[model samples]
Target: MKRRWIPGCFAALLAFAATAALAASDDPSYGIIAKHKANSAVRISDEGHRIVYGSPKTPVAVEAFYPLRAGGEGHEWVFEYGYNLVTAFPDKVRFVAYDIATPRGGEVWQERGLTCGAFLINGKREVTVNGKKLSFLRSTTMSGWTFAQLKAAVAAEIARPRPARAAAPKKPARPAKQTVIHVTVPCGLAGPYGEIVHLFRARHPEIRVTTAANGIVAMLNQLRDNKMTSDVFIALGLRELDDPAAQKRLVSGSITPIATIPLALVVPKANPAGIHNLEDLTSPKARTVLTYTPNLSGGYGARQALQEAGLWDRINSKIVTPKVPDQCKQMLKTGKGQAAIIYSTCLKESYLPDKPPVIEKDLKVAQMIPQNLYSPVVIGGAVVKTSKHPAAAKTFIDFLRSEAAMKVWLDWGFTRLPGA
Candidate 1:
């Protein structure tokens, strides 16, 4: 009977060893080993000796791979392949190199951005804690990093000591207070400033803000028609602010300017039509020009420029009107005309492939003639007088003017107003 029991124990020991091996196998090999920088929230991967950041734009050379032990549910080595080089450690040993791999083999979806973190089979990313993985994970949101860096960060975390746990404190009798705010913002400038809004939301999760990108006139009409929506109104023209009807509809002391935008001339690159100055727009050679329909801001700017140039008739003949700024941009991109008179901001936002052909080069920002005719496009925010959440709207507006909040808007090429 004792001999039989010995055999049973031997079998049990073998089974335990196999299970351990399988768990260990879940960890990666020859992949991201570690990250060096803390403030640099970039993800990384390994390509043999080279470490690559997730973004294709910024690749740096990696010096070494320091592997770490994987515990609990284990980590998956998902290689978003790209020819990007990244450094493992910045201070001790900063190795900056480039990734030379071709685009054919790399993951495409993450070309825009990438990060590596605890993930579950249900398609939710989680946060790794102790030996166990926890749920309710916050998504890793970031910019300015390539794919290779993401992989290296995972490896580095494994090698480093786990973050020290803090002692659980006694529960407070009162719950932490949070402020909720609501705001209405313009849709046109919304996309460029999304990061700013997101940052503000992170701080004041209670704030329920909304945005609409419709033209200014349309927004005012909505308010007047009483089909109004949103806690705040953001638009371009100042006339709305001074209007008796609009003033009556707006909450007192809520109207304020947030940013100042300058007018600019948008033309195709090289200006083949010899349209160097505003006067050139009237020359006989100038056959076609891009502008928004008479109703839009771009069209108004074009009209003003022609008037200043003293050749409204010459420029008018070449008017190629479009309904929207993006539409006019598209027309210019396709070489539909030589140039389009548009806002400088629109020109800055237009996307053209890197190193485009000469014909595409014609699309660009042009200098204005004498006096420059700088049109001050003011973007303002106001609380709707009829909004049910008037207090919330005020809180949201305050968040937009916060020091932490202004940085986001500044990044989008907006100059904050004196009070904003």
Candidate 2:
């Protein structure tokens, strides 16, 4: 009454079962579906998902919109994905991606990358969707999946209808207010600071920033006395932070370096004294202009460099102490001094060749002190704890460390901090 199954038939059935199980297990939504399902506020629709794929070595950024059921308004969520260059694969294969979401209007919250999910297919070919974990078929396993495939999968999942919920009462919207942040920095940083502030404003139009450029000592003294109306202080060196009074003004653990300006010698366009090298400054005819020692960062850097070259004492008597780096350049241009030592960025001609004639004329970088002989002047900043716009101040400070800000620093002939 019972028939025995053939060996080949039994093997075929087993293979079919394994394939079906693998297909059922592989869900490549990158955990977005589960996350949306769990959160009561998140409403996913077919029109709300976007995916952008990047070439190798670059990052992929995704923007997803989830409308709030209460207000029928939504916020865009940005997520980025890339390879983790610092941590090798199998240990930490993917760059942690974060989502920028505004919980309340004008207030932002950054969600951690892992909680959002990851598409890691190297050593372990797995996709995390919502809270459910799945893996790709072994036959289909690869180091990474195409952006198109992932996007299609996610789009299909998000298109499915879900249970509707009741709308909650909407809270009245508050009028947007502008936050003004006052920044104090050394005059030597005027060029880079201008560019950084401009870019920061462009990125955050709701926040207004004003900058005051003065000598570091004067700025520090003003900050100590509360005479300066500033929310951020950018100094020439870390030593400025060591001052007890200045330290108290800074928000704890907020000191961050932004850039470095190298010491350079500026000479007249005519090369009146024929000053070209460090040794050339020793000539009696070398009426050199210098920054005042100890107080001026550029002056201190120049003195250190000259001392290393064994030309400090020889040039000291000939020195004309200028109040600022700009003054040093002016002295050289006006023929008041044959040579001037200042921060390399002070001479616009050194980096900005296409600058206007009035600003670009009559001064050239004669020499740049080698890094081995003298260190560059560091530019750093900290948020004042007394700042009324402390959050905005911190955001501006953080922007100074962005790649766009670093480009501005580099364009002005200043050295960018590593990993900035």
Quantify all predictions' global Cα lDDT against the true fold. Answer: 0.48, 0.54
lDDT of 2 by residue, 1-420 (tens): 124557677888999998976654442233333443354332233212222222223222222222111111111121222221212122222222222111221011111111111233322233455555453210111112344444433433334454664596696543388887777656456556655665786789889776544455556766676655578888876656767887887899989887887877778778878888889988777855556555555667777888998988787888778543345555565567888777666555211112221144457788888876766567878998878988888899889878899897787777876444
Model 1 over residues 310-410: C-alpha lDDT tens digits? 77866677887864344666666556777676655553331111211112233667764232453445666788877877777776667666777677556
Please give the lDDT score at residue 106 for candidate 1: 13
Best by lDDT: 2
Runs off by more than 4 Å, candidate 2: 1-175, 213-217, 239-242, 349-359, 418-420
Which candidate tops TM-score? 2
Cα lDDT, model 2, residue 234: 88
Off by over 4 Å in 1: 1-184, 212-221, 239-248, 293-298, 350-362, 368-372, 398-406, 416-420
Q: How many clashing pairs per prediction, in order?
A: 44, 4
